[model samples]
Each structure stands twice: as structure tokens, then as C-alpha cells.
Target: MLFIKRFLDQVDEKPHLSAVADQLREITYEQLCSRARRAARVIAKISSEVMIGVAVNKSADYVVSVLAVHLLGRTVVPLDSHCPISRLKQMITSVDLSLCLVSRCQEDKLTDMLQASIRLIYIEDAIGEEDANDNAESTRSVEEEAPAYVVFTSGTTGKPKPVLMPYRALNTLIDGMAKATEPRGTTLLYASQGFDVSFQEIYATLCYGDRLLIVTDAQKKDLYALTEQLSKERVTRLFLPTSMLIPFVTFSLYEGVTLFDLSEVIVAGEQLKVTPIVRRWFKSHSRCRLINHYGPSETHVVMTCQLDNEPDDWPDLPPIGQLIAGSDAWLLDERLQPVATGCSGQLYISGRSLALGYYGMPELTSKSFITHPLTQERMYNTGDICVLNERAQYEYKGRHDRQYKVRGYRVELREVEVAVLASGLVDDCLVVASQLGLTTSLILYFTAPERGQDFSLSLHSHLAATLPEYMLPSFYRGIADIPLNQNGKIDTAKLPQVGGVRPRLSSNYVEPQGQLETLVCELAAECFGLDRIGANDNFMEAGANSFTLISMLAELRHVLGHSFRQTDLFEFPTPRLLCGNVQRSKEAPESKNSIASDTKRKLRSAAIHNTHGRMRGRHA
Candidate 1:
């Protein structure tokens, strides 16, 4: 509440200053406040404390809608517009939401998914354009414990649970951020709106009378474009999840450039594991301060670990660092008693930054958020196993429930992912323990290297050399990119299931005819460790996974004196068809990027196209 009041005060002082910007245009502080006030008049008519959804999108109007809803003391629900239609419906039903605010870009799909009983107000439509018939609301005292925002996160029982955070928590967070960052500059709101850090970014930007820039959906998918935008805008601060940070840094290094204006880089949503690339980034970049921030959705940001210094300050486990203002961390054993230094315990956070509790789930709320034994203050059980060091700093060990027994020895999947990242070949990796009857298989999913580069074999070799046999994953799947949730965390639910039926090739063969076809055959045969030379050999059956296919294409480009895309393998798996495409690529060097886009076109021309199905031999 204090932060909100102070933010408005700043806005009043600098009414003409640029407040927020998207990809297209910018809005001044005066327009933002005037629209928020008009929208507040409309929102005041709604019943008090009713849940209202603010669709997570990159629009200035969405920001205005959020501030307007807060003015009426109604709880704002940050919904992921990209969530499954069915899940969105279920959430609407659970929360009894009758109204939701959305941007024009998201209106069509959401309206189609939503029931007629629900109302969708376009953000621009909510505010009065000409200031006509304004129904101003009377001033009232705000309650200290009233819920301000409810963020839904995945629970252990496979359900989306909503956590209600009070206004005090947000105010404390904004105050902390105002104190931590520089007094004035632009801050990027690039993470999903549902993410707690996004709230920090929005309010903190306003508190400093600074500019707020929302990253468009297109820029988020492309690292080069995003960096260019950030540099172009001269954004001084950015908060990215660790998953996105590594790739952006890697692409920056590959391009041999550095951002001159960015002053700080804050990474969270995953463990800050030190890698060779991380060391190199620190060594090379001296202007930007690298910070490792840690907090659950329940506690707002609490701890920070500075990573500017290199190897000597880093250990196997990165410290979550010192506590934030008005926050306290305790290391307690299973019995809720203090543990000795260096001993592992469940970390509990007690502070004004705590969320009120889970909405509509009283039992869950009571179970997780409990009273501290000594202080009698409410505390949240983080479910994270942490160890206190001699310096009184807390280090994140892993999740309490992330441990699994493999061959009678405990394995931490975080350790596995950390090791994989430390190898310097992979950027983001996920290790899942898939059950197969009585035994569990540790399956590793990783993103392949950039086009025209090969690293899967080297990654496998590195894992073997580093870890014991029991700790190693049985099946390694290299994907083009790692799937991420709306929160920018790994989407575990979307990972490929293990132990599925493996496709087989039929008993058919078509020998290579053309020179390009023969060369492709040899490359595929050598890359997959197979001796068979046929035009219709099933790539999957020949032990060629996605990672090997990229390498195969890279090798093909080198030998043929032309560039072939990684996607060309999937579109034209048959040697004859792929060879024909390669010859065209050689002839049309100017259209290299478009050469990959012609995948479906080439597939349509083929007599038989198996876009995803296995290519059979002559006989079944």
C-alpha cells in the first residue's frame, strides 16, 4: 500500500514522463493514470474482493488495467493467456470469475474459449476516451491484510493452486527493489506477468519514476532480436530466468559482442550453477553486475548471491545468499528444530513478504504456512533442502522431494542437470526419473547446439566421464529447444514419455542413384554408426536422433560446399529427396535461410511424404 501511494506521488510529479512502452508505442505517466482512474470507476461497481483476472500479456493497457483493479481493493488474478483452453476454463470456474481484462491481441482466442456467461473487457475499451460520465469512487481506508493479487502455481498433487498475496508483501518488495537498484533507469518487464518478479518489475519501475518496457512475444523467442532491442532501448536492468539467460549469453559470445548500456542482470527461477560459459561471461563483462536471485512464488524476492567474482567464490552449490530487508530464513530439521551448521534442513521463510495463503484451500493453506515456534510469526515452508555454512549464509542443496533412489543410491536430479550444464556443451537440461515397472530410468532431455554444429556425442561422452554408471541417464534425447512454461521454467509435463514403442523400418531398400544421394548415404551411415546404404532407410531406425541429424547436415554442408538446414533432415529423410534438396541449396546460395522454410514444399512434391511416420523399406 505504501509503495502504491508513493508510486502515484511520483506519477503526479512527472505526469508527462514516459511511463510504459511496448514494441509499438509508449504511454506517458499522465495518460496511464488518467486511464487507470477511469477504469477504476468502472471496476468499483464490481462486488468487493471479487476475483478479477489480468491476462498475462505484453501490453501497456494490461498494466493500466492491473493498477485500476488495485484501486478498487479487488483481488487481481494473474492468468496465463497461453494456458490450455480447458485449464483456463477450470480456473475461471474455480475462482468464480465473471470478468477478465484482456488486450486486443488475445481477445479472439480467449473469447472463443470462454463461456458466454463470462465477460471479457478489452483493455482499451475499459477506459473512457473522452472522459465522459466518470463515476468517481470515494476514498476509503485500505485494510492491512486484504488480498491484492492471487497467482496460480502448480502444486504437487497435479493441480493449479492459487496463492493470495496481501498488499503489504508487494509494498515491501517494491521498497526493497527501490533500495537495491540504482535510483533511476529503465527496467524490463520480460518475464510472464503471472510471475511474481514481474510484479516487482512493474511497481519498482514506477517507484523510481523510471521507464517500463514490455518485451513482445516475437522478441522473446529470438535472442539476437531481444538483445538488439535491449541495446537499442538502452535498458539498464533486466530480469531473466536462468533458462533464457544462458542462451542469450551464449548467442552473445558466439556473435562476439557485448551490451554497453545494461548495468545489471538478475537471474532466477532456477539454480545458478557455475559453468565455463558463466565464468567466461563474468570475466569478459565488467560493467554489468551479475546477480543470482532466489525466492519461491510465496515469499517475493528475499535473497541475492552476487556472481561477479570467479571460481574462488563459487562452490558446487551456489548460495541463495543473505536475507532481504524484513525477511528471515531459518534452517530447521524435520522435527522443526534448528540444525547445526553445514547440516541440511528444510528452509523456512518468515517475513512481511509472505503471501496471505492459498485461496479456497484452507487445509493446504494451513499446512504449508504455519506459525514459527519461537517468534509466533507466520512462516512458509519452502520445501527446499538448504545448508547453512560457517559464514551463516544459506546454500541451496536441492529440493526436498527431488531425491530418488537409483540402484540403492540416492540421486539428485539437480546435481545431474548441474553437471550437464557444467560441461559447457548444453545450455538448459532436464533430468526426469521415469518409472519402468519396478526400476526407474533417468532420462535426460537437452537442447541441441546451433545449426551446423555437433555436440550431442561429446555431451554423452562427458557425462560418462564425469558421473558414475548409476548416476548416468539411460536414454538421452536431444531436442531442438527445451520447452518452457509461461513462467519461463521448464515445462516438465510436456517432456516426452520414456519407454514408448520404438518405431521400426520395414524390409525395403532403394539404393542411391545420384552422386549427391550417394554422398548423403555415406554421411548418414558414418554418423549413425551403421553400414547400410539405402535411399529409404528410416533415420530413426538407423540410430540417428535429432542431435546427430544436425551434425549430419553440418557435415553435408562442409563436403558439398553449401549450407543445409537441420530441419531439412526431417522434411526429406529419404536419401534421394534430401540429395535433390541439397543440390538446390548449392545452386541457390542467396536463399539459404529460406532453404529450410521450403521443407513442407519439398515434402509435398515427394510421391510419398512421411512427415512424422517412419519410412518403410520395399517390404513390410
Candidate 2:
């Protein structure tokens, strides 16, 4: 059955049930259907294009606009509101989008960013109560094989490639999820709008007659806020990126709070590690199960491992588990021949869950989606290296590109990361290879429970006991947290520069000399959750990012009664430098340099406010 048909049936069954909600408002199934119908009529009058862009923020309106596009049998190209104008333009141009749906609040900003050739339709206007009874269903029949939506890749290698998903593929995902997870009261919509996971969060919940709770940016950034919201809302189902699982579970365990109402916690987008803290969390909240789902954007979700057993019995590194319904996977060697049982090989997936291929890039699509040698069937070449264990479950060894040669020794980055995590000293760790002039250096970036604690020596000793000498990281850096991009995956680009002079750890802490310097140190310490911040400590090296910098700037402005530009933090990264600048600024408040600094500060504030507005519209 068509997903749209199923959704409509759900609406008929539960007309007054809450379908989707954000922090500000809630909409019932009946109201959602009405809004979609209204928006569809407006879109039909605007254009006959098959592909429509939905650029609205994550809210009930965003959900309405997407449904309206589906109602008209048009493929949706979900655009991130926070993306740079250049990147958004690339996505729009790549999809050949002629019309985009924008929210009233963001219409002006989008108008300025988007080309004049691309028409912008206000979602508020489109869903207005005019012509309430107009026919919204498309006159043209939408075939099951026709494209349903387009989601772009992360573009780590090059330009982001648009993966076209057809209706049949979406159906496969919905059906598979229904079988894997039991129906619950509510599912948190934690993913960003453009992410493929958002589709699963939005559609899967609505199809199951469950309320979809959209998380706000503020809640998502703060662990306490997120957990409180989850408990208050009685959120039964939750999905998190694998990188976030450890920190989230650790925080929850530290608080000694168990969300007894939560039924399932699904994690994906990276390898799953069932650390001691994670096991304890699940054991305490016995009602909640941890499910590790594995799939690339090319195939929505193909395999899943559910830790239904006792937490103590779970493996440290859980397997990706068995294939989902209607999905088929094969482990093939370099020559495309099937690998022997228990041997590692590249994973290949073939089934209805496969996407239609990259939009407007036939060569790339042909390269990634190839024909199986023995079966002569179309299959996606998943670059993941995996091995079948004794239980017939697939264990994720590592990614094909993540394997590196260090000092003439083969090393899997994941293997090293597992070793660090097993030490139990750090909450999370990322192992990366840094290329120097003539030698490659292994750098380990980690986040520990106590940000002020220096555990480098202990971590090194722990890894040395298990891993070979070559696998050990040459340098260890403790960060405030593992940086995750908007999509909730580890943002490797945001990791600190490896070759630079390392910052002095807490052990070599230096005291502040003056009142101004002391104030700066206190603020830095509070922001980073460190007990003490040295006057000469580097900001970026201490795990300061754009968000943390903005926070510190706000606090500084409050206390100093003077505005400071973000660039000031970049220029004078240390507490000592910042205090010196503050003293100078106070002495010459009206100087020419001060005037110029004021102007730059205003511009920075405006830019930050704009970003904050977009964030407010998204999940917490």
C-alpha cells in the first residue's frame, strides 16, 4: 500500500489525535490533513514542477508543506535553513528546483539568499484558510517507482550528491520499522530537516498514530534540558547518533534518573559501543531497549542490532545485526566473490530499500550502485568492512577509507577507538591520522567525565596493554566534548589542528595575576566545565567552539558592560590576552580602533541572532 494512503487512513482513524508538535504549538491529525490540503492547492496554482523545495524550519508547518508536496505527487528536496547560501544554491541548482516553500519568518532572508529565478512560496500563505474545500489530490497519478523525495549526502568527498528515494523505498522503510519497533505513544524528532533520519522520525511516527515531538535547538545542546523535556513529554521512542549515545547515557546515569516511560532508544550514523555506563543505564531502565541500526543514506536502514539481552551480556562492540525485512545484504571480497564465513569483506545491499541513485550524476551513481556478479542483481556497494560472527550477525570492522598504515603497520581507526573507550577513563574517543612532512602521526581526541582531569598517561597505559605499539596514539588531547555537526555525526573538520603547539594541560595550570584576568579565567572555567582555567590556556585547544564562544561573549558583555566581537576571542584566545584587550578597550572607549570594533561587534551580533532564529525553528 502507498504510504500516503496509509497516512490518510491513520488520519481517518485518529482525526483528533496529535500528529506533530514543536515547543510552541501542536496540531492534530485532522488539522494536519487540512493544512496539507490547503498548502497543496497553493502549490498546484504556483507551478507544475515535479520537484519542490521545502526550506521551512522544523515545525508543524514544515511537516504540512512536505505532506502537501507528496499530495501533489511532487518530489520534495528538503533544504537546511541554516546552510550557507552558496551550499543551498548548489542543492537547489542540482535538483533543478524552480519553486521553494519558505516560512513567513524566514521568507525575507531566503529571498535575499535564493536567486530571483527560483520562486519562493510562503508556507503560512499557502496554508491559509482560503478555498478550504478545493481539491488537493493530484490529478496526475504518482507511480510507486516515481521519486518521493531527495536527500543529499554529507559531501565529505566532494559536492553533496542528491540521493533520490522512490515511494516504494519509503514504504519498505516504514514497513521494516513497524516490524522492528513496537508502536509507542510518541517519537522525538531529533534529527535535522535535511537529514534522511528525519524522514524516519516524521513519517514513521505519524504512520503509527504516534505524536511526533520536535526537539528545540536549546534542548538538543543541553543534556539536562533534553532529558527533562523527554521525561516531561513522556517520549517513548528516541533516536540518537552513536557518537551522542555515550555522553547522553553517561549524563543520564550521573543524574541517577531513569526515563521509565521510554520504551526504545535507537542509535545510528556510526559504530555502536556498549560501554559500561551504557549497560548500566539500560539495566537501571530495564523498560528501555537499545537498538543499533546500520545503514548509509543510499539505503535508509538495512540492518539492526537490538540489545534485548541483559546489559551485562551485551558485547562491548555490538554487531550491526541481521538485515531488515525486504532488504538483502552480501559480504563480497575484492573480486566481487562472496567472502567465507567469519571473514571480513565489503558489504553490498540489494532490495526495494535502495534509493533511485544520485540525482543528475549518472556516472557517480553507476559507480556506487553496481550489478552483483553472481546474481546479476542491482546492489549498492556499501564501503563498510564487516565480518560475520558465530551468531551470523555482521560485526562492523571499520570503513574502507578509515584503514591507515602507521609506521608500515596496518591499523583500523575503529580498533584504536575501541581500545581507548575500553579504558573507561574517557566517555568518547576519536582516533585520526595526521600527516606530517614525512611521517604520519596518530592523534587521539577524547572527552572525559571530568573535563579538568588529566588522564592522558592512564589512557596511554591502558591502550598499550592491549593494542600493538603502532596502534597507540602518538598524542592525546582532552576536549570539552566530541564535536558533532548539525546532522549529529562527528565533524572531523572541526577537530583541533594536530601539528600546532599543544596547550598546557590542567596539571601545568598557571594562576591569573589581576582582577580582570581572574574574571576571564572564571568565565572560561564555567563555560568549559573545568575547575580551573589557566591564564595562558588556548580557547580552541581547550575545546571552545562557536557556540561556547558566543556563550562566553554574552557573559563577558553582562559583567564588563561592554560589547566584544567574536574575532576578539579568536585574536586573544587566552584569558591573559582577553584581559589585556579589555583593559585597553576601557582606557580608550572612543578611540578609532574602538569605533571599528563596535561596528564589527554589531555585525557579528546580527549574524548570530539570525542563526539563533533559525535554530529556534529547529529541534532542540
Candidate 3:
């Protein structure tokens, strides 16, 4: 392959350049290539396509082992050392692994997981410091389509899919990235090695001759420390899933923290919901370019991007932009025909990035990577249903199977469910799309907020105001917690069956006397999906927290000619108290125009001038 040889040539040219830095060790380019070549020599003796499983911690040795596999003209299966022992066994069995390369520390654990028949070689013992016996003599180099590695992704079905990639596809991606970004002096933050996105970070950094810095496992869980480290190191490039980014902003982790002249940051893997705090952070650190990246494991690292122009781009649905250099996107309807632009369709991708299909599962591979009607090219069908907007940007519309038609109205259960969780009243939640014979319904499972206050009434009331009656959940159950599947996603199978459960309002409370107070409480109850509003319950913690909702409340207060401060409503959303406060108002109700004008000015000014450092953290 072009890369294996090119990597060696680069090392020869710049031997002293830093290649990998992890925890307390740093490996130079020369050492990397030398070790890789030595390891490759050992790998060449092995039979099969040279697919070897690697089990190493976040260390320089782990990086060398990956490169070594490449040098041997064989694919490398990089396994997470920290994954469940059972998962490791399953992967080894599926890949028919010839050998495993692991550090001395993981030798015992590897032996426990691997079968007696399989070989587990220690890295320190297997690849010694001696120079590799050269392979440039008689052996002919293979072509580009040679397998590089097989990445296993958590499957929706029971088993995980081992997605295979060729050297050409990966090399093509590397070339495209070299063309898109700036220079090789970039320093990257390596978060997780198991995830494909981390691979993207690894290759992108090396190809550009940039420094690759690995974040420790402990640092990964601690956002405050991670952000501090990122700032301290002056890291220029980073790749993080949206789920991780949200909580970082929510907790004000960036407060008072000065960014390390960050040049570029790429966020992907999950839907990005950039909040107000994130927007302010980006504005203050305007030099950094926030890129919204999208793609599945099969399509290499990224397929599309919606570049961030402002910080506000974070909290909304970031558009999955146009296809990359060698890739083509076909948005097809149910009949497999190209749908009209702006119409929702199943997205299919073709070209180099399409994986060599799932490992061993030929049937599944054939089903997903099918031939295109007109082009005659094989394209991988992405189950995600998406709509191409007027800008030709792809706006994701939930999964095709996730859409449930309830009472003649097609509903996106995720949107409604996310709205509920956004209220902050629910600690955790899951929205399940299920069909009982002819009837379609949404089953919601949630855990109440930490204060032990039941939010059943308020959430339903708030949802009613924003959602159509038919779109609402037929059943909402509060559980101590929603169960997780083996792969860590919400497990729909484990959700309790709601067969005979009757619909019931969570709370029934009296209204306050003053008209202003009564209306606000009613509005709160409606917007929050609750049956009744309570005086003592904190509105912010109820998950009804957001700038948009605050804006809406201000609009309503102006329309009713009520003297309601946004924070006052936030502080006292309960009926009786708000009504009393409104009734005893000595100041006249400000004009609707004046109120709206002032609120807009204040929010914009606050956002632009929000220099206060507040430490906050949120889970994605």
C-alpha cells in the first residue's frame, strides 16, 4: 500500500520528529518506523491475511504496534484493553485472529480471555530492540485494496459488526484531510482508541507530521482536567463526540479558562446541541474553527461537515454537509429511486470510503452494500432517513425504522423525547417506538430529578403546549432508572411492558388566585408536560432550562401586559406565589415592545460580554 512505504520514507527523512506522546512517554518518527519494520518482519512469517488483534493501554507501545502491523502488510485489529473480557473473546473468535500483541501489564488478562489454541505474544518479548531483517529483497508489495484493519462497531442487533477497510480508502481519507486542513505542526488530543473517530485523529496527526497526545483514562472521565490539559498543552486539533461536548459546556468547564490558541476542533459521532455557554466560549476563542463532522464506521471517519460560523451552531442540529472528495451520497426514497431535493430519503454512500463489507457476514454485507440502479456502482445503504435542505445540506431526520405513524401523523419520537429531557426535570430518560398489532405508541421511561420531587405532572403539561395531542406519548412511566443494553445504548427490550397500564395524570393541584400568576403556571404546566406546577420545585433543575424557553416566557409576559421578570418566573414558576407577586406590583406593566426590546438587548449583551468564569459540567 502507498501508506506503509510512505510512512517509512517519512521516518527516514525526519527521524527525530515526535510521532506519538502518551502519558509519560514520547516516541520519535525514527523509532516508530524501526520498531514497525521489526514488528512487520515478525508479522510476515504469520499465515492468513495477517489480521492481528492488539491489546495495549494508552501508551507509545500501542501506537508502535499499530504501525508495525501496517509495516508487515497486514491488517491490525486494535482492541480496547479496558473492554469487557467477554467482548474481547467474542472479537477474537470472530476475526480468527492469528496472534495478539500486548504489553507486559495486560499479559495475564489476555491469557484469561483468549482460548488455549490461540497465541498471545507479549510486545516486549516478541518485538525486540534489534533492527528488522529487511523485507525489500524478494517479496512483492501488495496493492492498495489490501485490508488495513477491521473496526468493530456496536450493532443494533445482538452482535457487533466488524467493518473492514482497505488501505486505499484510508489513504484517500488521509490525502483529503491533508488538503482540507492547515499544516503538519498540529497537535491532537487522542481521547479513545477503541472508537473509529480516535483512529481518524491518530492517522490525521501522523500523516501531517503532527504530535499525537493521548489523554489518560482518568483524564477522559474528568472534563475539567481534560480541558485544563488541552489549554495547558496548547493543543490545536481535537475530535470529540457531541455527547461529551454538551456536558463540558453545561458545567461551564471553559469558564475563566483561556483556550490554547486552538486552531481547529472537530466534533462528531453524536448530534451536537451547542448551548448558550458554548457559543460564548467559541466567540471568546474566535481563532478556533469548530467543525461538525458526520459519518458511520463503514464510511471511514467523516462523510460530511457543517462548519461552525458562530458559537450558536453548537446547540442545534448541525447539518451533515456535502460528500467528501471520492464519496457520493444518494438520498433515495422507499422505492430506491432518488428523492426530490428537500424530501426525506434514506442516505446511501458510494465510492472509496465504503468498507469491504462486514467481516464474515456476507449476507449482511450484500444487503447493505447494494448496486446503484443508474451508476452500477455498489453503494452502502445507511438506515438513517435524512432530508436535503434547500442549501443541499443533509438534515438528519431520525432512523427510517424509528419513525412511527401514530393516528395518521408521522412522529419522530426522539425529538419529543429530547424536549422532555431538555427540561432538566428528568435525570435520565428513554423513548421507545413500539407497535402493538395495529396501534403505534411511544413508551417513555424516566428517572425523576435528584431532589426526589415527582415531575410526572409538569413534564406532560409542558409537552402538551409544544406537541400535538396525537404526537404525545400514550404511556409515560417513571423508573428509578432506564436500563442500558450490553453495548451501553438504551435497551428497549428491557423496558417494562405497558400492556394493561392506564393513562394517569401525575399531579392535581389548585391554581393561584391572581390572573397573571394563574396564567404563567398554566403556561408552565403546558410547556413542561406537567399536570401541576409547584412553588418549591426549581424550574431550572426541572429540565425546562433553555434560552429559547426563557425567550418564549418573555414574549408571553409582554402580550399579557404582566410585570414578570424572566428570572422571577424562573425563580417562582408556582401559581400562588407568582400571582401574589404580580398582584402586589407597584410598577406598571412595561409595554410589550419595551419588554421584548430590553430582553433581546440584555441577552445579546450578556452573551457577547459574558466574561464570567463559571465551572459547569454536563453528561451528553
Candidate 4:
């Protein structure tokens, strides 16, 4: 609330400009301030306690509607455009929403749903309805302990649990994030709107007089054009999931031809396992900076870790890293005892970044956020397992609630399962960390198309690039189909168990030849913990990436007595293509100069032309 008046006061100075539908639409500072105030005035006339859903994509109207609700002193729930109508209906009913701010594009799709119980209005209409006299004259004391936004998470109870985040908590997060990333006039891309991180992006950009680029739901799914826009827009900041980052790297946008002059790139949502080639490509592009960010939604946006080292130098699985500016963390044992450095335990996060609690679910909130028995400070039990390293940084081990011990090592079934999914071997996969009595074992369940090629061999090949030997699954099982729970999560309990035998594919493609291929194959076999390697295997679809590929390249280069950059492998991912590229690079040149001779020739040509033009002008 402290930011409200200040944010409005500065609105006329710093406006938000967006490029949409191939046209540059500028939202001036004064316009935004005026719109928010107007929208707020309109909303204030409505019921204050009633929940409202703002269903709009990346637009000025969406921003204004959000601010309007804030001004009206009401909680605004963000519902993404991508969510299904059924889900939206359920959310509306559950939250007891009295009104919905529907975007113009969404008007046709959702017009029928508007009824007597819930009023619906287009964002543009609401903005237009604001009176000229309406201003921030009616200032009130800010609510110190009230919910600002309620972000929902997928729940096992077949419904989403809305996590209520208060203004004070968000202010704490904003302060911490601001201290860590001092973006002065920076432009940050808003990737996830429904997610709490969107708020961070919004506040961060507005607070620092920076620009917030809202990527349309369409643009996010379109990688090729998105890359083009990123370069053209001169966008400097970006934060998204690892899944999204992989394509950005694999496509080689970092090499050149991007719209934006990206200075900082932060990836989160899931674990970051960037390939060596990706890292090397980023390093070469001196203008762009890459960071691995780790956090949970419950902590506002981020609580810990800003990965600042080489992805390869990091652990087999990189450490998640240290606590953030206004947050603290600890690894605790089963009995709530603090674990020593390098010892794994459940992760607990504390400090001002904590949220208010789950909306209308006080018991569940109490269970997760509890008093630190000794310090008596409120701490959030993250339900994640981690280890505090010697550097006092945290290494993500697994989920405490989801994983269990198997032969002394705590096995994260989902980690293995995600690796499997990333391998592109199976359509749906789930690794259950269950036991048959005292003996512990993992059951890998997957489903693929009946006619589609088997991925077992490819899975082994891809896992070699990222996972360690000990973390490998004890058994592989193929189900006719993977059962999905009502909440859309994989139903591991329903997976039928099978014998401990690797399924064989019917493929008959011959393996590629040459010593480099042989060496690559050998390294793949070792990294994957596989007995054999095949030629027809794809690098990424099989889950191989810049990180693991780098490891393979490191070993291969050492044996070959020459260094190969990460770009070479990514350009030529498979053994056959990789060997060809490697051979070509080796035969072409070993020069490590920053600029090529041809580039110098072009620069000299331009300089001579400029000199001649200047001389001609003086004579005239």
C-alpha cells in the first residue's frame, strides 16, 4: 500500500509501451495513472469484500483493471486466458466471485457465462466509464495484514488451493528482489501472469522506471518469432522456466540476430540444467547475462539462489544456491533438528517473504507455516529435501513428501520422472518412490503410442548426459496407458507394476561410423549407465542437452587432445552430425581470435567509404 500513492504519483513520468498485432501501442504514464484511478473509482462502488477474477491477457486494460481493484481495496485473482472454461467456472464458484473483468478478445468466448450472481464487463468499457473528477484524493490508511492477491496452485484434492499473499509480504519481497536486482530503466518480459512471479515483474519494472514486456500467450508458444522479437525489441531482462530456456539456447538466439540487447536472463520454474553449448553461446554474447534462479510461489516470488557459476562446475545436479536478500532457509532432519552442512534434510524457509496463508483454508496454512520451535519465528516447511553445502548454499536433494530412502540414498522419484519426460521417450511418465515392505525400490511407469518407437534405449542415452549413476531407476515398466488424477497430476498409485526388465524397441537403424562417433558413443554409454549406444538416437528429444553434452565433449576433447566449444555439439547434437561438425571445425581453423579476417575487411571497407564521403563533402 505504501507503493500505491507513490506509484500513482510517478505514473505520468513512466508509461508502459507494448507491441501487439504488429502495431506499437503506447500507454502513456498519465493515461495509465488516469485509467487506474478511474477503474478504481468504478470498482469502489461495487462490494469490497466480494472476490473478483480478472480474465485478460497482456494488455493495458488488464494492468488498469488490476490497479483499479487494488485501489478499491479488494483482492484481485488473476485467471489466465489459457485456462479452460470449466476450470474458470469452478474458480469463480469456489472464490464466490461477484464480478469478472473480461478482455475484449475473451468477450465472445465467455459472454454467456455472465449472469445475475456475477457481473462481467470488458476492461476497455470499465476504463472508459471512469469519471474525470475521480482522483486519489480519498486516501486511506494501508491495510498492514490483508490479502492483496490469491495465487492458486494445483492441488491433490482435485481443486486449486489459492495462496493468499498480503501487501506487507509482497512489499518485503519487492524490497528483497529490488536490492538483489537493481534494474534501472530495464525492460523485463512478463512470462507467467497467473503465477506470483508476474507481480514481481510488474512491481520491479514500475518501481525502477523500467519497461514490462507482456508476451502474448500466442508468442510464448511460438519460439521462432519470440526469439526474433526478443532481438528486435532490445529486451534486456527475461525470467521463465527451464523448459522454455532449453529451446532459446538450442535455437541459438544468443549467438546473434535477437531484437533485444539482453543484459540479464534468469531461468526458474524448474531445475536449470543448461547444456554446455548453451552456456558457451551465452558467454560469447558479452551483452547477455545468464542466471539460474530458484524459488517457490509460497515465498512471494523468490527466496533463495542466484546461480553465478559454470553449469558444468556445478554438482552432477547443480546446487540451488544461497538465501535471497530478505529470506533465510534451513535444512532440518526428521525430528526437526537442523542438518549439518552437506547433510540432506527437509527445507524450511523463513523471513518476511512468506505469504499470508491459503485462502479460506486456515488449517492447511497452519500445517505448512509453523513457528520455529526454538526461535519462535514463523517458518514455511517447503516440503522439499535439500542439503546445505560448505559454502552455506542449498543443494536440492528431492521432495521430502514425495521421495523416500532407497539403499541409503534419498531418491526423488519425480526428478527421475522429469528426466524421463525430458528425454522425450514417453508421452506420460511417473516414478514412484514406494517400497515392498522394508526393501526400497522405484517403479518407473510410462505410456507411449502403440505404433510409436520405444524410447527405452534413447532414455538410457539421454539420462547419461545429466543424471548420476546412483540415481538411476531400479526398474522400467511400460503401461498401456498412464492414469491421470482428477487434478491433472500423474496417478502413481494406479500404475501397474512390472518385472525389472528394460523394454526393447523394434528399430533396425544402423549406427554411424568413424572414431569420433565411436568415442561419442562410448562416452554416451558411460554417462547414461547403459550397456550399449545406438546411432539413430536424437540428442534433445532423448533428453541430452547443453550441460550433459558439455560433459561428454569435455571427456571426448581430453582424449582427442583438442578443445571443442559447446556450440559445435549443439549445432551437431547426434553422434553422426556432431562428428561431422567437429571434423569440419578441426580442419577449418584453430584460431581463437575474437574477430575473423573477413570481418576486418568489411570494417576497413566501411571506414574507407566514410573517409571518401567526408573528403568529397569538404570539396563541395
Best by TM-score: 2
lDDT of candidate 4 over 98-160, digit per residue (tens): 787777677555556654447876677667854656555534456846777877664444355
Question: What RMSD value applies to candidate 3?
Answer: 13.1
Superposed by TM-score, candidate 1 places the C-alpha of residue 587 at a distance from the truth, in angstroms, of: 3.6
Candidate 3 residue-wise lDDT, 372-461, digit = tens:
999999898877788887776777776765544443233456666766776777887777756421134566778885545666667777
Worst 10 residues of 3 by lDDT: 611-620
Better TM-score candidate (2, 3): 2
Q: How accurate locally, in lDDT, is each candidate?
A: 0.68, 0.76, 0.63, 0.60
Clash count per candidate: 2, 6, 34, 15
Relative to the true structure, candidate 2 reaches a TM of: 0.71
Find the 10 residues in a row with the least total lDDT in model 4: 498-507
Quote the positional error of residue 392 for candidate 4 in Å.
Answer: 2.4
Full candidate order by lDDT, most accurate first: 2, 1, 3, 4
* Candidate maximizing lDDT: 2
Quote the lDDT for 585 in model 3. Answer: 62
What would the per-residue lDDT of candidate 1 be over residues 126-231, giving only the tens digit for each residue?
7858464442442344565777887766554434567788888888778777645355678888866666777878887887799999887656655546777888
For lDDT, candidate 3 versus 4, the one ahead is 3
